[model samples]
Target chain A: MVKNKIKTVACLLLTLFFLGGCKKTFNQPQSNPEAVFNELWGFMDKHYPMFAIKEIDWDKTYAQYKNRVKPGMVDAELFSLLNQLLFTLKDGHVTLMSATDTATYLGFYKNYPLNFNLANIKNNYLFNDFKKAGPVMYKIVSNVAYIYYASFAQNISDAELDIFFNDIKATKGLIIDVRNNTGGNPANAEKFFSRLINQKTLVKYEVIKNGPGRNDFFEPKPFYISPNGQTYAKPIILLTNRLCFSTCNDFALYISLLPNAQIMGNPTGGGAGLPYNYILANGWKLQYSATYTLSPKMRNIENGIQPNRTINFEPQDENNGKDIILETAFNTLSLE
Target chain B: MIKYYSNKTVFLKIGLSLVCWLAVVNNACAQTLNPDLYKWTFTLGLGLNSNSVIDKNFSQLPYSGNGLGLSGSITYQGRLIQQQLNLTYGMATLQNKYYNSLYATYFTANYSPLFCLNNASNSAFKILAGPQIAMQYARRNYSGFVNNNSSFEFSTSLATSIEISYSIIPIGLVLKNKIAVPVFSYMQQPAFGFATFFANSGSQNSVKNSSDFLVPNKFYRIINNFTIDKQLAPRHKILLSYNLDFYKINTIREVKSIHNNLIVAYSYLL
Candidate 1:
């Protein structure tokens, strides 16, 4: 009986282990004005990708914005303050999403001269009945295969590439128009780049944030594309505009690197950095760049990547059903 | 070397429950035991578990309150090992307010071969040790965040259970207290911020991080349930139980979870 009693005591002692380990936890942050501001500040200090190149003083920015925050203010009021802080990053990808709304910087394209009037091309060039080959919209223009790839969001299959290029294989050259593409998956850009290069090419490099420290980074890694056995040897002209962001910017930089390809039009609206999301206490999600990408020459293209030739259309030229940029690419492609 | 700190509040609550249990057992006297027994128990419980994040990856701050936890278990006792063998199948959930939750479905086989007396129905004390294997699925999703992700975990643990049971009447009432803890466990954690549920080599974007289903010394778990069963008929009984279950996993970050439940169930003894 005594031995049995000893066993009972042991079980109770073991049960005590559970009550001894509790600690404080937080799944959601409280709605404190100060806490929300601090979270935003901390998140940016740790996650923003382009601080090194943008040359903004984050500490000074924090001190300036911290003074504007106040208690009993609505989310919208606080969001305005955060928007101002984010705008200081000069990043086109940094964005704040609240319960009811979203705010981001379109500064790259906004207030800049517009390019690529699609309606003019549809009515005057492709004539509204351009063959819809898979996800690409294309037509033959003046003996050149004019293929307009609108967005990388649209998947491009190798079979579709074969069909499209095969149709234009007999033409003088190829005009690949990706004008207003705000970007999507970079893999699509790789797939499209693969068809142009006969050998592997290192187009860009990337470095993602590794730690909470503002300076933390993984050593930059090379991003490359391999040659597709079947290649397009004809002269390739890539069209661009200020509205080209993200993958569009990446694509323009890459396609222009090809020996046979040339980039024409205005500078690209650069968002070469990759964006990631974080959840706020109020269930709002704020997005900021977490990865930094570089051009082949190790140039920071966060603000904008320049084209080989900068050209603009005139009013008289457009009134005559001629886009000066497209005509230039057409003339260049036909001559080459 | 990494520094580790367990939650302070958790120690207080578990410590208090331990004191309360000690108080109750001390007041009760020993009773008779049955030498022959064969039975099956099915239990369902609902309770709240205050869970805090594990390790230094998360902020070490006080949590607001407890989250709702639920569990269901089935056990069978038969003459298999030394005196008795018990096999249990259980499923448990530990959820927090941040839209993060953990679910574990498990199978445990334990043999209580050594008793203060025998493996009979009327044994005063029993010590059981065996393996508890479980598949754990965890999810954390806050839509706007870029790194919000989910994972599926597989683990094996060596479980120890100390059980004390007493019968006050001929065969009418029985109170049982069991404290079970997995001394150490190894779990398979998915790669940080990567999903491998359907990972395969194809068009691209396939990095196989779910390579190992067994990793060493990556997990720990604990559960203690105290139950009182009162016989209603020859083969029927009413059971009331209170249980606490906790789980932790550490790789890049810690996945700490807790479950507590007060269970009332109808048990049929065969």
Candidate 2:
């Protein structure tokens, strides 16, 4: 009986040990203004990657914002404080989403001149005679093929690429306009670049945030653009403006790499980092850039990729239904 | 000369030792065991399950949900050995405090062949111990983030399993408890970001980059099962069970998950 009792006790002890050994406690913060502020600041302090690049002292920012969060602060008040905190980052990809309001920072493009006019291009240039091919609108004028791709959100399949290239095969040069294209899937950018490169080209580098430290990052990896689908070898001009962001910024960087291509118009809106979402204790969501893309020379493209030739769109030209940027692209393509 | 031993070397040595020990024990206990008795049983189970996960690659907050689970197992019991194969699948809609929901699904399968110990004892206690091989595939779909919306984990583990049963003759009931702890595992999770920019050979490289052979120090898992069974007829039995599973992976980032299940099963003697 004593031996049996010993065995039972042993079993009970083993069970308890196993049950308690691997358990972990989750510390979700309390739903209060101060807690929410601390949580947001703490999360960003760990996960945000561009503190040094943006030249913001986060600890100092925390000090400035911490005392503002009161015990009885309303949600809107708290949201405004957080918005002010995020605004200092000067990132186009950052947004604070709540049930009632979505706070965004549009300084990358909103403060700049709106350089693109779609009505002028349709009426004055294409004369409303552009042909639609899948996700792109194209027109041929004076042996120059003009393709207007408004956004990368829509995919251009290989078959569609075949049709697009076949229709523009007879042209001497091409003008690919992506003005006001904020962003979309980067895969579409890759697909579009593949057709432009004749050989595999090491286009840029990419790095991810690996640690919580301000400077902790993985070694930069090479991003290559390989030749795929229909190849286009004619002189190519990529039009851009401050409204070109995210994948459009990537498009600008890619077009600059080709010997046969040049980027015209203003600098692209810089949103070079990949954005990710996080939730706070109060159920509000915060989205911020988690990974950053680097140029082939390992330079930061966060402030926007500058054009090969800067050409400002004259406001007077808009009154006459004339797009000077488009006119410049035509002149540049003709010179090529 | 200084020799450096890696985790892989330690795992191989320990695994070999366990295999040799099992062989010796099996041979030693063979003479005392009856070889004529054999039985086969098939079991189908329905359960209510709940799980919580914190995948740091996506978010640090715990997302939890409840769902129904289905499990099936086939057991072959002999005089000296018992082998079983079990499969389970579950689906859940996990939510956070912010009401953002993520749909999750997981499937698990394991096979274990245990050698019976204390079979000749008259103390109303029976014990079985052996090694188990288990595989789990789990995926989560969250639309809250672009490029990081979906993530999946595929892992295979080699675990040590132990089972103890106490039979009550007067009440015609059996109480059994089983525990399995993984000693070594091969886990495949997503990379730092769900997908890297222009990853060579496309997007699947994220899954390939995060695959690693890990020991218990890096990845820990435990499965605990308890059941009370009563025989309805000579060829039928009903069981009520509670199972708990927990696992944590400690890499650059941490991912922890816990599951609790309450199950009802019917066994058909075959």
Each prediction's Cα RMSD? Answer: 9.0, 4.8
- Candidate 1 deviant stretches above 4 angstroms: A1-28, A157-159, A227-229, A315-321, B1-256, B259-270
Clashing residue pairs, candidate 2?
A: none
Give the 10-residue window scoring lowest on summed lDDT in candidate 1 chain A: A17-26
Candidate 1 lDDT over B101-219, as tens digits, reads 33444343433332232333334444333334333443433222333223444555556555556554565666666655665555565443233331111234432243233233455
Q: Please report the candidate that would top lDDT against the real structure.
A: 2
TM-score for candidate 1: 0.71
DockQ of each candidate relative to the true complex: 0.14, 0.26
**lDDT score for candidate 1 against the true structure:** 0.63
Error of 2 at B163 (Å): 2.3
- lDDT tens per residue, model 2, A1-336: 756764684577457545743443356648789878887888888788889878899999999989898999889899999999999899988999899999889999888887889999999999999898778899999999999999988888878888888898889999999999988878788888888988988877777766677888778767777898668999999999998998889889989988998898999998988787877778788898877889998899999989888888677888889898899899877776
**Which candidate should be chosen as best, given DockQ against the real structure?**
2
- Per-candidate clashes come to 22, 0
For model 1, how does the per-residue alpha-carbon lDDT over A62-172 read when each residue is reduced to its tens digit?
Answer: 899898889988878888888888898877888887768888988888877666788889988778979877778899877898988888878888788878877887888
TM-score of chain B of each: 0.58, 0.83
Once fitted onto the true fold, the runs of candidate 2 whose alpha carbons sit more than 4 angstroms away are A1-28, B1-36, B76-83, B111-120, B129-135, B154-160, B183-186, B195-208, B211-220, B232-236, B268-270
